[model samples]
Target: MFTVTPEAQKEVSVFFEGKEVQPIRIFIHGGGCGGPMVAMALDEEKDNDVRFDIGGIPYVVEKDLFEAGKPFEVAFNGMGFAVNSSLQLEAGGGGCSGCSSSGSCGC
Candidate 1:
């Protein structure tokens, strides 16, 4: 299962406060060149999504994308909050073959 770090949760809570709707997190499981990659966004919840609490913030994931071995973590980089993936989607010795651009692997 995925988990949101305390720092990320705090940021999200502050950001969504007083908004009309609760912020929704989306996990898009396809991008880049490898056919299936990872993407995330914040928006209204979708119909086929599952809701869960992480570090007190609400998170949503597509039903199909919710797998048994998910290793997700929510953290803050220098600028803002971000979700990190534990699943290594790299491809090949040098780097990801599907990742055409440097550090552009959409995993």
Candidate 2:
């Protein structure tokens, strides 16, 4: 059940506007060194793909990926869109460790 938040639905419409509309394809992206990641792209339907509709938006995912990534959700982060999965992908920490101006870390 890949779901799209309301704000994401709007963004989706805007993103594909004036372009050829295709079902949003969701799949797990193996980052290897970085970690397992989920990604989305516009893709043509495949023979083994499963289709689902969320908020009137259609999406397709490979059967196995769908089983693994059920209950997925798409949301708009401040900078861009992000795919949130039940599988947690932890971030590599340690940011803003460098010296800062004034008394605050810019980050």
Candidate 3:
């Protein structure tokens, strides 16, 4: 199941106020040092996707992905949209020698 908090709903509504509304696609976004993260995109629905409606907004996710990340929630984290799910992602490897930052390296 998918849910959108009122705060997030309001933000989304404002974002689409003067534009054509499209279904929000929730999918797995490959992460950097943090590991895989959930993300949102505006896209057309596919045959293999599962759809959910929250506060008049349409959300779509791949069937297999949705099944694996069941019970997802979309909320506003003040800075941006935060998608929460039960799916646990394993962290990526430690920083490489070429990485510039000592903390959270991209390489």
Candidate 4:
């Protein structure tokens, strides 16, 4: 129940060079300063996941998580990707980590 913007698809294709990308898995993480955020990674299809083909890329989302994150969109933010879940995910500015003046709290 999510859409992947063309730019996002192009980025994903570049990530895998189009021929070797694996099924992508979407997940939630609590590392960013804003709090819990959505992320994606290459993953094998799992029994608990429901497959979705978006922009010709294969994606697998855990059934329960998918239900909770419907009406979402995956977009490319030029430098990277973003997942927008109808405002459930807010923009968490980048460079808010180590090596940057902003430390642990990202402030």
Candidate 5:
């Protein structure tokens, strides 16, 4: 399951109000140097996606890529919103050479 902090919910609400339909929050995995990455976006719904609500906002994850054991959190940082995985370092497999432990990769 995933959770959205109160601040994040407010941020998302403000961001999506002008968009068509309800925005769908996408959680993408596996794309960095170490092979897994985290990416977020709002887009139209796609087939085979898992849709859920957090604080009344719509969120989606690719069904095939979804891991039942993963823990996730969404929060707001200033004007931006961020998502985090609560999995251990080992569960992340390994750090990307271009990605700092903080999850910022210049690459």
Candidate 6:
């Protein structure tokens, strides 16, 4: 299932306040020091996508990814949207062995 909070809906609404709106695509973003994260971006629908419409906004996630990350939710945190899901990633898949907290690893 896919869900989006009212606050998150408003946040996206405000972003498109004066422009044409596009569907928000949820997908695997990157595998950095923190690991691969689910992220959102403006995109069009695709043949393999699963779509959800919430609060007048459309969200789409690839079919396989939607199944892997079942029961996804989007909520507005203080600063921005936070995506929660049941998807699991392998530990240390991105390998941060020598990375430091001083932004040296570009985390």
| Best prediction by TM-score | 3
Local lDDT at 17 for model 3? 98
User: Which candidate leads the pack in lDDT?
Assistant: 3
**Which sequence of candidate numbers ranks them by TM-score, best first?**
3, 6, 4, 2, 5, 1
* lDDT head-to-head 3 vs 5, winner: 3
Task: Please list all clashing residue pairs in model 3, or write none if there are none.
Answer: none
Give the per-residue lDDT of model 5 (tens digit) for 1-107. 76778888887787767775474655655565556445578676678777777766778777755564256677788956666774332325454555664565444
Number of the candidate with higher TM-score, 2 or 3: 3
Query: Tens digits of per-residue lDDT for model 4 on 3-79?
Result: 89999998887877737768988877654555567778888999999888876689887888888888667899887
Task: For candidate 6, give the lDDT of residue 5.
Answer: 87
- Candidate 2, residue 66: how far the Cα is off, in Å: 1.2
TM-score of 6: 0.85
Candidate 3 least-lDDT 10 residues: 91-100
| Candidate 6, 1-107: lDDT as tens digits | 89998889888999989888789999887767767778899999999999998877889999999999999999998787888899986635445654565645566
Which regions of candidate 1 fall more than 4 Å away from where they truly are? 29-37, 90-107
lDDT agreement with native, every candidate: 0.64, 0.74, 0.86, 0.76, 0.65, 0.85
Assess candidate 4 and give its lDDT. 0.76
- lDDT (Cα, tens digit) per residue for candidate 2, span 83-106: 887766653333233334344544
Worst 10-residue stretch by lDDT in candidate 6?
90-99
lDDT of candidate 3 over 1-107, digit per residue (tens): 78999999999999999899899999988866566789998999999999998878899999999999989999998899999999897756542433465764545
| lDDT (Cα) of model 2 | 0.74
Off by over 4 Å in 5: 29-36, 87-107
Q: How big is the positional error of residue 5 in model 3, measured in Å on the Cα after superposition?
A: 0.5
All candidates: TM-score: 0.60, 0.72, 0.87, 0.75, 0.63, 0.85
Error of 5 at 82 (Å): 1.5
